[model samples]
Target: MGAPVSVTCLSAPVSVTCLSAPVSVTCLSAPVSVTCLSAPVSVTCLSAPVSVTCLSAPVSVTCLSAPVSVTCLSAPVSVTCLSAPVSVTCLSAPVSVTCLSALVSVTCLSAPVSVTRLSAPVSVTRLSAPVSVTCFSAPVSVTCLSAPVSVTCLSAPVSVTCFSAPVSVTCLSAPVSVTCLSAPVSVTCFSAPVSVTRLSAPVSVTCLSAPVSVTCFSAPVSVTCLSALVSVTCLSAPVSVTCLSAPVSVKCLSAPVSVTCLSAPVSVTCFSAPVSVTCLSAPVSVTCLSAPVSVTCLSAPVSVTCFSAPVSVTCFSAPVSVTRLSAPVSVTCLSAPSLSDVSLSPSVSDVIISLEVLASLGMDIQPG
Candidate 1:
């Protein structure tokens, strides 16, 4: 309403772009981008990337160091990435990102953008509109084609593609791909090949210095890796995964799932149900449907199942088997040669088996 205020900022090897009608703008410490179109906008990207874009609306955006990628279209969105690699994309909206030596990318369309140190390369692209792209590293390329997008790459190479729903990608030293269909999607990859494709709503995939893969079709999907060779896939569901070692796989379809693999070689599968699986050593597997199941294994192989009820199975040492049928079941097996077969229908029971207790009861339990 006051003849559209215009401001430009600079911080050496940093770029700040501001266009169209503006109300107020400021950039401190590093290079930043701000675009205000016939509205009042305030943006601060401290150590992260905070981008705010609004049409005839007031917006405020801020970001810290947490690898937080939030993409909101047609409104105001706030995000923070703290000491981690995170990406956020918003079309006609507001988004933020923060990093400490972490990879990050933030993109906005017809909105105000603020990006900080980044430490990695930052790219923003667009067409027939105001598009801003900035890179902060040597030998880094920032590319934006058709409709104002932002892409950031690290010491290596990073690529991103978005159509209609605003996509964001951040890579520390690996490759990440995100495909969004009518929703906000964020994909962050660190030293691995991570792919998130074909979703109907908000979903996030994160990989950290591990060989990991995650795929989601709908709902909220989250995959975080601190290990090697981890895989997760979900369709119209929420999948939470945490890995600390090699070879962990999780698959879910229209269900609520939680998996934590601290050791190696763990697998889980679920359909239209809730399942919780935790593996401590090598080799643990869980497959369930329409029930609440928990399987915990330490230093050996273990298997468990529950249908229409609650089940918990814990194992220690080698070659232990515990099976329960149709009830509230609990099996605690320690130091095999021990086997338990329980069938307690519609009741509450606890069965404890130890090799030392079996030997005390005049039964010979061989320890292999």
Candidate 2:
């Protein structure tokens, strides 16, 4: 048989063996097995499990209702499973697999592969050079026991556990958890929270949610949380954190940093090195331990405290408090609300307070 043959509507189990010819088998309701020796084969099944084995020619298998298993020895393989689980194993050539309903498991011993899953979990174990996987509905778990991997998830949570190669993950709807044991990782979350814990590499996280929390513990971390009720904490790394809403808190234990809070009721705390913090609304507090600190508050009821370095505090509206224990302190209060309080205490250094247009009873001091 050297010509193309097409078979349709077989209600019993169908078995095909083709040699040096093209074959197209379709509309089968039972189990189908196809073995192509040297020619290409295309198999489509309606409600049955399909098994395809290709020696040196390409194979394309499409299943609508049952699980599909494809094994390719030399040429490329493309498998599409609509309602059931899919398993694909390729030895030398590339493979492209698409699954719509159930779980998908793909293992490529050698060769690059691309896998996409729509409604269930995806598990990919690649031992080749590179792999790309995308998941839409359920959680995705990828174990890159070998090469570099790039994963993008849309609806559910994403968990990437990488051992040696770098991983990049992007999530749109649910939480993203990345545990990088040896390589660097970068994660971006749009609607849910993000958690990253790295053992030996750096991490960068960005979260955009209404009440999102970002926690990073690694070598170097940069976090940006862009909503209300945001809390960012970094331990044992150089951290640069930015919070863009009210009731925000930024805390760093061991690094020099710059923090900016764009709403009211904000707090910034640093342990070592110089820090520059800016608050754009009222009820702001800045506390520093060992380095020089500069704070700017645009609204009322501001507090700045420095333990071992110079403090520069600027307040645009009233009820400001600036206290420095061992260095010079500069305090500026612009417009005081009615019954506002301005208290400045510099223990061993000079204190300067410039109050402009105090609408109520306030204190003004000028050094001559």
Candidate 3:
């Protein structure tokens, strides 16, 4: 008996058996059941339901306002500023858990688990698992009502926020940036290089086989078959990209990139740079390539097909179809009333139309 045992305003059931001395248990709002073995334990301002067990010294737990459950074996465990639903388990030392606003679950078997600034709804699992995991400023807010978050095998750098339940991220090989406002997010087997930003839900990214760099932003995004050697960039939503089987480089600045190529070799670049590309659909057969294709402020509809390459179309207002021009083909229609179907086949070398699209092509211009 080294003389220091203070249990203030107790209701019932309090046990303290110290062999070497130094044990201070303070309960301000009562309802306490405290047990300390083998000295050195400090617990302060506990509202209700506190269980502290320290074997072989050095355990400090502070400020548990409501609903707290802590269990530490073999010392060295520090838990700070917990509001509600906290369950901490430390088997063999080295665990620092910080400022959990509400609902947190932490477990460290062999040490090294750092969870930082989580604002409600959290579940972390590590079984000999922690080779650099850094997650910063996870924002899930809209009254914060949708919950179900899982992060598995995170090999450093994870930033997540998906509102409206249903977020699953698996095997993130590193470099993952995700942002979805209306929920419904699924990213699977990403071998580094994944950047997703969608505002209105309905996002599905599957089996990104490797060598990945995907950038998507808004308007009902659906990207499928991101095999390998992938680089996709979509800006203004209303997007449907399918089966981009290897060697894909697509860049759409003001929305309207519908490129369908089945036999590989694709490089589609549309940049009005200032918002006014209603539609640019490149429908390929064997070879339909545009090296220098530019449409400055086309309202709608400009379909071009070149067998040997080089087809240039510029339309200020709708409907101009140029077919199978061998090489060096140019069709310019400014405020087209009606080009009335311009068809030129026989290895078209050079054709230029500017006189208001050749007087609206009154005779259905057919020169082969």
Best by lDDT: 2
Judged by TM-score relative to the true structure, which candidate is superior, 1 or 2?
2
Give the TM-score (vs. native) of candidate 3. Answer: 0.36
Candidate with top TM-score is 2
Per residue, candidate 1 scores C-alpha lDDT tens digits across 1-368 of 34665443444323323344444544444534444444555555445344444444445544444233444456565544446565656677544333445565656555555455445555544322333333344123333333433445564454555544455666667555555454566767678476666556566667777576656666677777776577778776778777777677888876678878777777777765677777778777666655677777777676655454466766666444444455455655555553342223333444434445456335776766
lDDT of 2 at 5: 70
TM-score for each predicted model, relative to the true structure: 0.37, 0.80, 0.36
The best-first sequence of candidates by TM-score reads: 2, 1, 3
Error of 2 at 324 (Å): 3.5
Clashing pairs in 3: none
C-alpha RMSD by candidate, in order: 14.2, 4.0, 13.2
Winner of 1 and 2 under lDDT: 2
Local distance difference test, each candidate: 0.56, 0.75, 0.54
lDDT string, candidate 2, 1-368, tens digits: 68877778668888888788998889668788888888998988888888888888998988888888888887898888888788888888888888887778888777788888888888887775577888887888777765787989888888777777888988888777777676787877788667666765677777776444445554676667677465667665666667777476767676666767777477778777677777787477778887788878787467778777788877676477777777787766666654336666746247654445332345454555
Candidate 3 lDDT at 17 equals: 65
TM-score, cand. 1: 0.37
